[model samples]
Each structure stands twice: as C-alpha cells, then as structure tokens.
Target chain A: MARTAGSDGERTEAAIREAAVDLIARHGYEAVSMRQLAARVGVQAAALYRYFPTKEDLLFTLMREHMEALLGAWSEARPATTDATTRLATFVANHIAFHIERRSQTHISNMELRSLSPERLTFILRLRTSYEKELRAILRDGAEASVFDLDDIGLTAMAVIQMITGVIVWFRPDERLSVEGVTQTYLSMTMRLVGATTNRETQHVHAGTRLRA
Target chain B: MARTAGSDGERTEAAIREAAVDLIARHGYEAVSMRQLAARVGVQAAALYRYFPTKEDLLFTLMREHMEALLGAWSEARPATTDATTRLATFVANHIAFHIERRSQTHISNMELRSLSPERLTFILRLRTSYEKELRAILRDGAEASVFDLDDIGLTAMAVIQMITGVIVWFRPDERLSVEGVTQTYLSMTMRLVGATTNRETQHVHAGTRLRA
Candidate 1:
C-alpha cells in the first residue's frame, strides 16, 4: 500500500511540474503562482507542497529534467561512423524535433533560466557550455580537414544552437511546412553556412510558397 | 517658456528609458522595477509615472523604440545594389552590427515579451513577423538566383534570426571576441547559411586573430 502511494505521489508531482512548465512557457515565470499551477493540475494548493517545497524548486526540477533530456538525445544520436557534418546534422534535427514537440518546456527552460539562483544557473550554463564544446570539437576537426568554410567554430556552434532553438519561437504544428521539411531546410542552410559542397540541386520556383521565391 | 519646459521633460523621460534599457539588459527584466528605474535616473518613482503609466508601459515603450531602431538600421544600410549576394551579405553584416550595439535592448525585449498582454504581445509579434518577412523575401530571391539552397524560406529565415538573436543569450562586451570579430564570424556563418558564394573562399586564420577553430 505504501509503495503504491509513493508511486502515485511521484506521478502527482510530475503532473504538477508539467502544468507549471506549460503555464510558465505560455506566460512568463513571474506571471505564474502556486495557486494557478495547482488549479491547472486539479490539485489543492496545499497538496502541491508535499512534492515541491516552493515554486522555485518546482521550476528548478523542470529545468533539470529538460537539460538531461537534451544531453541524452545528443548522446544517443551520436554514432562512431558519424562524421562531423552528419553528427551536427543529426544533433540539429533531433533538437528541432524535440523543441517542436515539447516547445512549452523548452520555452520555459530558455526564458526563465535567469530566475534560478546563481549557483544553479552556473551549473546549467556548464551543461550548456559542455554541449557547445563537444560540437566545437567536431567543428574544429571539420575546419582542419577543410570540410567546412566557417570562420569561427565557436560562433558557428552558437548560431547552430540559436537557429535550431528558434523553432520554439514560431513553429506551428498545423503549418504546411512539416517537421521533416523544416529540419531539411535548416540542414541545408547549416551545411551551406559551414561551407559543405551541397551541389545537389532542386528546381527553383518564383513567388510560389513563402519558402521559395 | 512652457515649450522649453516640455522639451526638458521629454529629455528626462528619454534618459530614464535609456537607463532602464541598459539595466534590464545587464540583468533580466524581472529584476527591474519602477523604483529601481527611477533611482537609476536620479528621480523618484512618482516622478517617473509622468512619462510611463506603469512598469510594463515603460518596458513596452522601450521595446517599441528598439524595434523601430532595428528596422531603421536595416533600411538605412540596405544597399541599392540589386545583386542578391551583396544585399544578403550587407544585411547579415548590418544585422550583426545592430545585435552587437543594442545587445541589451534586444535581450530584455525578448525575455519580457511574454509577460505583456495579448494586445501588446500581438503588436510585438507583428514586429517580429515583419522582420522575418524581410529575410524570407531576401532568401527567396537568393534561392531563385541559385545563390542559396533551401527547401523552406520561412525555416531558413527563422534560422538566421535565431542565430543572430541567440548572440544576446551569451554575448558579453567584456569577452575577448570584439564586436568586429563577432561580426565577421556571424557574417561568415550567415553568408554561408544564405548560400552566398562570396564568403566561401575566405580561409581560416586569415586577417589577424585566428578565429578559434
């Protein structure tokens, strides 16, 4: 009976965190409160404290989970045979796919990062830095081999992240541009940005879709 | 005499807004308040309200000004040259220059946009859409001219904006990378992203300061 209760409690906590992430993403962190979050989760305000000591703690939990997920996705997609370009392409695609799927969580993590304590924010920054560093190493190798034409790998790495992260800013599920389409579009841009010989060609259209002139 | 007094009042209000932009950029928007803003401008909170009715209004006004400045800069630097490559390259360089100079305003505007109301938020969204539309038009033209390779212009435009906008997330003036260096780096990536063939010939470690691989 106790085991079942603990499992239920954990589930409830997860629900609360998810609700908070959604609202905070839609609204800013400063605009949300425990009462609002509790209402969203269909739980009483007092009951939430049984799982999270404070709103900050709940937000922190969400951020921690998101980071782990990002790190995991990148690591899982990486393969031994993956060259730098392919590795980066996979990384960018997976990231855009994840952001499009869980935009609310991703939005919260990116915008409200400063709300955390200095120590906690530093820890998160390190994870971010480490992630960028790994990509930079690949970029460095590519530049050394003359496979890419990027001037600064650091700047390019940052641009890759920003470009992919922007998916959360305006991407819509109902849009005609499918996830595959967006990913392929970004991949093409990224490859060209890095100076890959993307010689394969596609027919040109003038003033057709907003994507093609 | 009355007109002179009005002009003085306008100057003070502008100063307060500038100080608010500077502070909020260094710190996130949530950490700012009317009281702190007034203090920064050497005025009391009550006096501050003569210009801005509320803290949100002040932020909104600052955001509007910043957006106008961005649009203006883009308009001013737009070369008369019809060549898609030069126009896009100039746009990329001009965009980076704006990002570097007004880093703080852009940072605060994005972070606080969601904290605003539906009416206010819609206006900001319009500002963004128009900006995105500019890139979309340019990319579409470039793709038609075979100077760019992309499946979706909308996605490509977002990638470019996000890549540039992402700089505010980590860029620091105190850092070793100069505004010029950052500009060059972003220019290369953005140029490549847009399928600009002009920048592809530039080699690594070219022009002093080996842009860290």
Candidate 2:
C-alpha cells in the first residue's frame, strides 16, 4: 500500500507500531499490556483501542505486518536469474540485509508466535511456509541441475535460514565487519556448504554483483 | 545437586522448576510471576521464596543451570579422537539430542536472557562463550590440520550452533523423521558447511559412524 506522506492518522499508527515493536521485543507479547503500550506512545488507552481493538489484535498486526514486509522486501530484491548459484547468493544477501535492518520486528516475528491465536497463527505460518518454499525451490533446482550438492533439501533450507537469520543476534553496524563483509563471508560459506558444482562455474559468480533492484 | 528421592522439599523445588520452565516458555519470562509459578507447583508464595529469594533469582538459576547442563553434556559427549571432523560430528549430535529433549528449557534459556540482571547476564554469557569457544577450537584445529576449510572461525561456529540448536523449533519425534534420521542429515550438512577436506588423510573420517554416545 502506498502511503501519502505526512498524514496525522498514518503518523499516529506508525508511532504506535514503532513503540509496540520495541516494547514487545523487549518484554515479549504476553507481558505487554495495551495500557502500557498506550503510555509508551504518549496516548490515551481509548485512543490506542481506536487504532487496535484488543491486545491480541495489536500483536497480530505487528506479526502480520512483519511477515508481509519481509515478503515484499524479498519480492522487490529477488533478481531475474536462472543460475541457481546466483539465485541462492542473492537470497542470502537480501535476507541478511533485510533482517539486520529491522532487528526488533524480526525478533518479535520469531519469538511471539505463541501469543497468536490458532487461526492467526496459521495465517502467519502460511506466510512463513511460502517464504521458505522459495529457498527450497532454489535448492531443488540447484541439486537437479548439478550446480549444488545437497543431502536433504528440507534440512538444508532450515539450516541456511537459521544460519543467516542468526546474524541479527550478534551483529552491530559498528563491528569490525561491514554488512558487505559479513554478507561476503556468509555467501561464500553458503556456496561451500552446498558444495557448488564447479570452481570454474562458481568463481565467476559474484553474489553482491546481482542483487535485486 | 544430588536429590534425596521422596524428600518433600526437593520434590517441591523440582516441581517448581519444571512448572516454571513450562510457564516461562509458554508466556515468556517477564509475563510469568512467582505467584503463578507457586500456584502451578501447589506451593505457597512464601515457600517459593524460601528456595528462590527473588523472581530474577529464579530466572538466573534456570538460565545458569541450562548453560551448565549444556556444558556438562558436551563434556561427556566429547570424543577421545583428535580428529576435528569427529569432534564436530559429536557436537552436532549431542547438541541436537540435548536440546530436542528439553525444548522448553532451551526456549526459556534463549528467549529470557533479556530479563536477567546485568551481572547474571554476564555470567550466563561467559558460560556461553566458553561453550562456543570449544567449537571455535575444533574449527581452528581442523583449519590448521587442513581437515576443514573455513572462511571465519567465529562466524562458522555461530552458524553451526544456531543451525543445530534450531532443530528443536520444528522437530517432533512423531513426525516423518526420527532423531537418527534428522541427526544424519544435519551431520552431513554441518560437514559440508565446513567444507571437510577430502584429502587422502582427512577423507577417511566418517561422521555417521562415530556419533550418538
């Protein structure tokens, strides 16, 4: 959805979301009350309700938006490529870049699934499954074309996702490595992990060179 | 600590710990109260304090014990062989097994560090550092001996740990894959991630043959 820049309602909603993500990420979803959230946003409790009807509604919105944002980011970043190696490279780079930029939202998305009701949980899980399936498809294509060697596609996909997503846990922008440095190392490790088909084929492919526009 | 079987006090403490783990894992650390925990254990709030002086004390105890247990498990599981590949294989299997069995404890340990006091958090972090350091040592030895090719030891160790620990997230014993099946696949993925050397000397090591005990 396109945002008309600088509207009162949009601004309040954004502020509420920003505060909610911070609070929920710090204290967890179950522990955070709408009153406390309203206080954090410097608004009345009724005003907060006007934006989010219930505590669970606020949480569901946060989680759903996080997943939606991730899906949108990936879609925009996805490159136009047929080579499995390049595709995998772009996937890793995009994932790291996106997650590191939204650390708190990412943390909430991962840690607060228990707070979501069954139906809402199922919806969020579907979003996650679809996102993950994209990576599985890449692995399958690579394995089928002999560009990557994989023992178990499901396990590899999970491992890669966990490994890459783990960057947000310890990464600091001021750390010794730049984002570029970390991405380079992870890309190389990913390629090595999959045992990329041939040195000649992989040596020419630069993961950073072909990221999504 | 050795438990005197059937002692009321010891059983009460154990029950409290178990219930607290479940409650905290389900609702997060900050969301769980000592009163709720006492109720879950069918004990009084006063009795709960007799064992754990404060709420944070209970959290610290849980986090500390989780790390200590992990360290002890790895120590016992550490192999006699000097081969890095064998050592890594053992680490993966033991980690996956230990974590999958105590899913709630693992969840609390990973998710509740935010609730720990600074000093206690440091203590827990120190324990984690030492455990991760063990993995780093293995990677260093393997790199020096040319049994493993790694881009960065720290990053690789972190990646391997997160990837292996993540098994508890989606893994259930009654599912399509058994523990052994999952371990074998993860073992292969871990080996491939490190780019295990296939040299005349290193190629002879077998990860699958030397696991689970």
Candidate 3:
C-alpha cells in the first residue's frame, strides 16, 4: 500500500513538472498562477502546495532540471578521444538533440530567467557558465593543438551555443529535413566557423562540390 | 497652442512605449498590466488607453515598430556594392548595433510573440520573413558567384541570423570588449562560417597567427 502511494506521488510530481513547463512556456512565469497549474494537474491547490510551496520554486526547479539534463546529456555524449574536432562535433550534436527533444522546457529555461530571484538566478547562471566552460575548454584545446583556428575562445563559445540553441526556435521534424540532416549541416558550419582543418571534407560533402585545395 | 498639445501627446505616447518595454522585459508580457504600465509612466489608465485601446494592441505596436526599425536600419546600412561578403558584414554589424541599443525591446519582441493575436502574429512573422529574405538573397548571390561556399542557403541564412542576433543576449558596453571589437570578431566568424576566401585575412588578424594556406 505504501509503495503504491509513493509511486502515485512520484507520477503526480512528474505530471506537474510537465504541465508547468508547458503553461509557463505559453504564458510567462509571472502570469501563470499556482491555481491554474494545480487545475491543469488535476490536483487540489493544497496538494500542489505540498509539492511546491511557491511558484518561483516551480520555475527554478524546471530551469535547474533543464540545465542538469543538458549537462548530463553532454557527459554521456562526451567522446573519450582527446581529439578536439571530434569533441566539438559531439558537443554540438548532443546540445541540438537534447534541446530539440525538450523545446518547451528549453523555452522556459531561456525566457524565464528574469523571474528567478537574485540568488536563484545566480545558481542558474553558474550552471550555465559551467556548461559553457566545457565548450570553451574544447575550443581552447583545439586552438592550442593547431587543429581549430579561433579568435576569442569566450566569444566563439557563446556564438556556437546561441546558434545551436536557436535550432529549437525553428526546427520541426518535417519531411524536408531530419534532425540528423540539420545537425550535420550545423556541424559543418560550426567546423568552418572554428576554421577546423577537417571542415573542407565536411563542407565538400554538404556543398556537393570539389574544394579548391 | 494646438502644436504644443500635439507635441505633448506625442511625448506622452513615447514615454508609455518606453515604460512598456522596460516593464514587459522585466516581467513577461502576460504578467504586465496596463494599470501598472500607466503608473510607471505617471499617467492614468484612461490616458494610456487613449493611445493603445487594448493591451494586445500595445504589444503589437511595440513589436511592429521593433521590426520596422530593424528593417529601416538594415536598409540604410545596406551597402550599394554587390559584393556578398561586404553585404553580409554590413548586415551583421547593423543587426548587432541595432539590437544592442534596444536590448529591452529586443527581449520583449522575442519573448512576447506568444501574446499577440493570431492575425497580429502573422503580421509580425511576415515582417520577420521579409527581413530574413534579404539575408537569403545575399547568401544566394554569394553562393552563385562562388564568393561564399555554402551547404544550404536557407540553413546558412538562419544560422547566421541567429548567431548575430544573439549578440544582445550577453554583450554589454564593457571595458573588456567594445561594440566595434565584438562586431569585428563576429564578422570574422560569420565570414568563416560561410567559407569565404577573405576569412583567411580576417582570421589572421584576429588569431594573430599565420594560416597554412
């Protein structure tokens, strides 16, 4: 009996998180009320409070989980090889796949940062900085090894993150392009942006043209 | 006396618009109320309604003007030369400059699209498509002229747009990097992403290193 009740509690919490992401994504965090969220979850407002004492807690939980999931994804996708080129390709692919799968959560994570209190906002930003730091390390290593050409590691890292994350803004699983195809093209562009030595081969495959070299 | 009244009315409207952007950016559009906005602008609710009859109307106005201002800025910044590289650089520079100057409006413009009525949403999207089309043309011309190597013109255009428009997210007029400096670096990165030949020179200057070629 206790096991069943615990399972139900877990299921309810999961449902609430999902609904909260959707609602907050549609309506900004400030505009979404706990009452509305409770109704959407088919739970009593009192029960909702039992789980999340405050609405800001719910928003912060979503944002934190989004970042944590992203970090976890990257950890799994991180290649064992020391080759910076391969590492970068993996980073881009992992990022795109993770974000594409959770579009609403990604939207909430990106758009609702303003709603987080100063301390909570700092926590989120720290997580983000840590994630971005991994990319910077890759860029820096590639530059040091003379495999990737870069101007400013920090700026390049930011540009790549923004470009890839922006994929969720327009990408839909359609006939004309699959996630694999889009990831391949973005990989090529990113390789070129970093002046990676292997970019010629990648670009040639996508452009369907012979390189001058 | 009539001229003075007209000017006063225009000033009041401008104040309302500015306050709206700030409020909406700080708190999401759905969370912001006209009463709160009027208080911020030091006006009565009725006076606020005199300029914008509905909250959605106010939102649409802010968004429409943001896009129009962007298009206007691009038009003025559009160089006469047919050189795709030059045109692309100009577009990136103008976009970065414009968005950095209007960070709050840019945020509202990006985040508040969900709040627009369907018709207003379509209108705003059409304006966006037209602006993006200009970049597509440049990419197409560059690809045709063999000046810029591209895999997919459409994907490339979106990637470039996202990469440059992303400047407003983190960039500030700080002592570490000025607007000109950041724009120049991004220009270099954009050039490389498209596989432009001139990227070699730009990369050399920024990287402070010799290229293999």
Best by lDDT: 3
What is the interface root-mean-square deviation of candidate 3? Answer: 0.6
Which candidate leads in TM-score? 2
Query: Per-residue alpha-carbon lDDT of model 2 for A64-119, expressed as tens digits?
Result: 98888888987876768778887888889889988989999988888889988999
Instruction: Give the per-residue lDDT digits (tens) of candidate 3, residues B1-213.
Output: 232345588898999999999999998998999999988888788888999999999999999999999999989878787988778877877888888899999888888888998999999999999999999999999999999999999999999989988998898878999877888888899998998876445443432211110
> What class would a CAPRI assessor give candidate 2's docking?
medium
Better of 2 and 3 by DockQ: 2
| CA deviation > 4 Å runs, candidate 1 | A1-7, A42-46, A144-146, A198-213, B1-7, B22-46, B54-56, B199-213
lDDT of 3 by residue, A124-167 (tens): 99999999999999999999999998989999999999999999
Ranking by lDDT: 3, 2, 1
Which 10 consecutive residues of model 2 chain A have the lowest summed lDDT? A203-212
- Model 1's chain A TM-score stands at 0.85
Q: Which ranges in model 3 have alpha carbons more than 4 Å from their true place?
A: A1-7, A199-213, B1-7, B199-213
Model 2 residue A91 lDDT? Answer: 86
Error of 2 at B41 (Å): 0.5
Q: Across residues B8-46, which tens digit of lDDT does each residue of candidate 1 receive?
A: 787888888889888776545666778888877877788
